[model samples]
Structures are given as C-alpha cells and as structure tokens.
Target: MGYVSQAESSFPAQVGKDFEEFIALSSVHCDGWGISTNDRQHAHAVLEKKVEAAAESATFQKVIADNAADGALLHLRWATKGLSISENNTHPFVYGDYSFIHNGSIFPPDSFSDFIDEKFKKLIVGDTDSERYFYLMMTQIEKLGLAEGIKTTLAIIKEHGKTTSLNFMLMNKESFVVGSEHNSEKKPDWAPADYYVIKYKKDADGVLFASSGWNQPGWHTLENHHAAIVNRSTFEIDVINL
Candidate 1:
C-alpha cells in the first residue's frame, strides 16, 4: 500500500512506472493518497483528500514534482474493516515526528487499543488496523528505542493476535524501517500473492522499499518476517530478523 525511498538524494520529479503499474492494477485502491517526505522540513507530509484514484489525480503529480524530497513515503488507501473513506483515514499518519503506513490487516482490529497508552490514544485519528499498528509501535518506541520498539510490538502481534500480514513501513526524519512478515500459507481466496511479497534495492541515488505490486526492476524480494533498517545520513542498511 506504500513505498519508501532513502533520504541520501532527491526523489524523481514525478512518480515512476512502478507506481503507475501499481495503480493500474487496481484503481479501487484510490480512496486517498498521502506522502511523507523529509524535505526542508523534517518528516513533513502532504495528503490529497479526494475520492478519485491517485494515478488519475493531477494534484498528486503536481505535489510530487514540486516537492522532490530526500526521502519519501507514498501511500494509496484501499478501505478495509468497514473503515470510512476520508483523508483522516489515509496513511502516512503523523504522530509526534513519525510517519507510518501498512500493507496488511491485523485480526481483531480493535485489540491493540488496550495495549495503547492513554496519552497516545488521543493521537489515534483513524480507524484502520494499520493506524493501530503504528500507535502500538509508538508506544513501544516511547518505552524502548526504535528497533526494540518495533521488534517488541511485532512479537506481541504475532503471539497474542492474528496478523494476516504485518508488512509495514515506519519513518522519521532521521531514518526508516520496513518489514515483510505474513501468514503466507493461510491466505484467503481474495488475498493475492503480491500482498505478501516485498522487495528492496539500493539504487544509484538511495534505496527503495516497496510491496511486490510495484514491479520495479532490479528489486530483490525480502525474506518473510525480516525487516530492513536504513540510516538517513550514512545510508547504512541492515536486514534483521523480525
């Protein structure tokens, strides 16, 4: 549902072929589109709160071209869990300084509410499992460091709850983290194989991370249940067990 690029260099003026193909595959995902970028302002983001498909939105192209950020997170929403269609539900949800998005569903959607801190509960403005996943990670990050926070949160989701797919991207001004984890063997008929596949590559300018639907050349598929962590300044990357 989203794509992430490392912050070492400027992003393309327009969204690329991979994005176009992704949208063409399903225009229904066009509930709304949001982008999180590390432009002059750290972790700044923009949202197009329209009901039209993003690939067909002139505003989407103009904003993307106007703000060629060092790092960017692009998301297209496909409503699930009976969530409503609105900008507030769109992804790249900002809390404190972090921007987060997800490509999977968490079973028992509201279960994470109890795990969320009372203070952070007020920060939850959306009704999607992805947003809950983001806040859950935030709660852990508030207690532990970034990596430990995500690691601990994921562990709980896998053990205590049922995650059809835990694939996600979480970014701040300094760096970003992404994961490719899911129940590949137990998918329903409606869930496509592309839903579980994620690919990553260190491009000439920076790095690229995305779900398989994008179809960018030279991207290597990430192993299931593994996460990639990349630093913004140094561009150092590590693939760790999730």
Candidate 2:
C-alpha cells in the first residue's frame, strides 16, 4: 500500500481503517511486514522491517497509527515456498533514495543473474527473489529514467522468468508507482481470480494505492500489465500500459 499527499500531512483515517482490514489477510501473507516514509527533498528514508505478522504486533499498530508523511510504502509478505521468513527478507528494501516492495514469486531466485549490475548485486541482503527483483528495477531506473526503467524491468521478467505475479509498489522522493502484472493461469488455485488485482482511489488531498481483497468501495482498478506513476508534488498520474 502507498500514499502521496499533496502537501506534508498525515494519511487519511480511512487509510488506517483499510489497513487494519488489510492486515487480516496476513493469515496468508503472514511472513513479515515493512513500511517506510521518504523525504521530500530526495534525502533519506525512515524504515522498519520485521519478521512477524502485522496483525499480531502492537509495534506495527502503533507505527501505523503514528506514521505521517508526504509519501509512504507498506508491504505485507507471504514467504514463497522455499524462502525463509526473517528480518533480512522483509520488504520496502531501500537503496539510495528509492524504496520498494514486491508481492510475487519467481523461480530460481537468481533468474536475472548476469543482467543485474554488480553494484546492486552486492547490495542484496536477503535470499528472496523479491530483493533481487528490486535491485533489477533499480539498475534499470539508473540506466533509463523512471517510467522506462519500470517498463523495461517488467519486460525482462516476462520474457525470461516464470512468475506467479509481479504486483508491487515502489516509491521515491518524487513519486509513487504501483505495478500490476500477474498470470491468472499461474495464480494459486486456492486464491480468488482477482487476487493479483491492484486498485487506487483519488481524492482532494492525495491518492491511495493498494492491493485488492479488502473492501475498497469506488476504487479504480489499475489494469494488469500496467503501471501508474504518480507525481508527489502535483498528484498528477501517468498510467502506462506495458
């Protein structure tokens, strides 16, 4: 989940309400929880990572209640089969001014091996495929600009890897981006058809982007194979069909 306010302000109360509801889904996505607040001047970020269920942690609840920022990212993790649940494997991975969180699994975690820039490869702190995916995106964003970097990363994944979903939320000082890319045929048979769908709601103050499953009345669904790049300062959004 992510939010970008028009000015420096706290998130809407409804966002907090929706998050409480979202946390209930942790029965399945119970591996970990992570969140971060980015600086407005492209400075640094304040982040927290934990290997525990958000629903069960008082600290998580307090942090969510006290969090205030112009831009933020929160991630709930569901450990892929062989991946271990640990603090190091948590989401909202940070590098420089960027923060990222992914919600999918790709086989052979190092699928992007040679493609990943060595500078980023050395930054890998966990054994999950999600961390690797984050670095890959960073590498592209470093090579191309923002939008193109994201698009190119998804292209690389689709062309070479076997993935269940590529749904993710990434934020930096200037913007917040959400990507929804999932193979319906590859989703967990036990999960609902709309499990990978991502949605967002825009209002006078700012915009809120989140995953589906919880009740999100009147929220606009971001299409699969697409990404929404939202400018933090103006709240202007550019939807790219990838």
Candidate 3:
C-alpha cells in the first residue's frame, strides 16, 4: 500500500531521499529493504546480496540515523509463505498510496479465493496469501474507514480461518494497523509467534511512532487488536480499537 501527496515527490524519490538521509544520520545497517508508499506502487524487491552485505556492514550504520520522514513503513522479511525469490514476492506490497506487509499466512488459498472479488482476485500477481489479504483489506478500506474496514476484513478472515491464521500489518502514510487471529485446533506455539512493540516520541512538532525502542527512550507497545493513528502534522498517536 502506498500514497503520495501531489505536492510531494514520487515514492521512489521519497524512499531514496529519506533512506539515504536516515543512513547518514543513524548509522544503522539494514539487511533488506521494503517500502509501501502513498500510491500503491509497492516495491518489495530484495536489495542485491552485495547491497544487503553493504547495508549490514559497519560503515552503513552511520548513514541511516540522520534521515527523517513525514511518513514511512519499513519491513525486514523472513519469508514464511510463497517460494518466489523475486521482488514481486517480497514485502511492502503497494497499491495506490497504500502499502502492506504481513508476518503470517492464510492457508488453503483456494478455499477463501471466492471471498475476494473476481477483479481483486485477478489483481493478485503473487502466490502468497499475504498479498491477497492485503488486496482484500484494501478493497474493504476503500469502502469503509480504516478501522471499520479492518474489522470487516477480520470477519472475513475469521470465517476462513477454519483452516488458517491471519496475522498481518496494514499502513497508509497516516496510520498503521495490525491484527492477529489463530485457529483453536492448532497449538499456541504452532500459531504465529511474532510480537510487535510501538514506541512514541514527542517532539515540539508532534509524535513519532516506531516499531521498537529507539535509543532515546519512551517507547510503547500497540496492544493486540488495536490500531495506531499518527497524525502527520501533530504527530499525535491515537489508539483505535479493532
């Protein structure tokens, strides 16, 4: 999912500009890169092994810390579904201005294929249920607000979860949402075991919400079944119930 303001530049421009600055300032090393911008021109391709190697090198860390973004979503994928190693199979699936990524799977894709419209089912260019689920949520969100759309989307996934699990992340430039559901038949350990932590930093302008703790302190976790909305201008973090 990706979006771009008319006044702002293209998705790739924002990523390269912001990322280069981030590297310069933070000195962090990134293994892989994935981004979803405002226009849905999702780019999840792997950086060349050499690029990843360079990013992980000590010299690269100094480059990331300097950059800042009004809105950004980053993903480090450890593929759990889909076998294709190409960029299309990677994270940060983009559509319009929305970008999406998931950490879990929806099994027996054939069984739930009908729940998604034929048009969207056709838009599915990848084999992973993660991308399908992202499109499903996007279709719903276009019809409903983010929170309500997520709720309705979860209902559909729950209906299909008689055989699978849904643990995923959805983000636009302004808000970030995540949800998890498991099958009763499967043991807890067998279900998705990933956990997420969200932290907030209040600056004079507004707040910043990060996935993990930053060096400065004051980070928080987004509870299960909850969504966090960060106002782009105010930087206020609003927690919405799923």
What does candidate 2's lDDT look like per residue over 79-147, in tens digits?
A: 999988899899989987789989888877877766789999998888988888999999999899888
lDDT of each: 0.72, 0.85, 0.50
On residues 70-105, what C-alpha lDDT tens digit does candidate 1 reach at each position?
Answer: 666777777775788777778778775577888767
lDDT of 3 at 66: 32
TM-score of each: 0.87, 0.95, 0.63
Give the true-structure RMSD of model 1. Answer: 2.6
Which 10-residue span in candidate 3 carries the lowest summed lDDT? 42-51
RMSD of each: 2.6, 1.5, 7.3
Decreasing TM-score order of the candidates: 2, 1, 3
Residue pair clashes in candidate 1: none
Q: Model 2 shows how many backbone clashes?
A: 0
lDDT of 3 by residue, 96-196 (tens): 55667664455655445666766677778767667777877877887887878877887887677543445465655555554544333443353223323
Candidate number that wins on TM-score, 2 or 3 = 2
Report the C-alpha displacement of residue 103, candidate 1, in angstroms.
0.7
Of the two candidates 1 and 3, the one with more favorable TM-score, higher being better, is 1
Mark the 10 consecutive residues where model 1 has the least summed lDDT. 6-15
